[model samples]
Target: MAGPNIKHAAYHGPSIMKEIFFGISLSLMAGYLWKRHHWNIQRRTREFYGLLDRGEISVVVEDD
Candidate 1:
């Protein structure tokens, strides 16, 4: 009983730690990508608005 419990604990300890590490790594990567995506969107929006402000582009509104 003692031997089996010790073996199980040893096996599960590293497994649990590996899972936690991967989870943290994935979360950090996802957060970084999300932040970059947000920045890119904001940059594009600013550029578009700047173009409109400069009369480089125009929008035509139509009546529904």
Candidate 2:
């Protein structure tokens, strides 16, 4: 019990718990957005394939 006086060391800024919560929330939101974007890409790809299969769109070859 022979430590120095440390009574005035309280941090008066954002709380650690709050910061952690916000960081976790932001990360989860980012992941959710990424998943949605991936799903969108997949859906578009499927649609494009369907169109091609049904002859709704065609591919043209060019000479080299």
Best by lDDT: 2
- Candidate 1: segments with Cα more than 4 A from true spot: 1-14, 61-64
Candidate 1, residues 4-53, lDDT tens digits: the string is 44433344345778889999999999999999999999999999999999
lDDT of 2 at 56: 87
Model 2 stretches with alpha carbons more than 4 Å out? 1-13, 61-64
Q: Using alpha carbons, what is the TM-score of model 1?
A: 0.64
* Least well predicted 10-residue stretch by lDDT in candidate 2: 54-63
Instruction: Report the lDDT tens digits of candidate 2 across residue range 1-64.
Output: 8889777877799989999999999999999999999999999999999999998887866579
lDDT of each: 0.88, 0.94
Instruction: Name the lDDT of candidate 1.
Output: 0.88
Strongest candidate by TM-score? 2
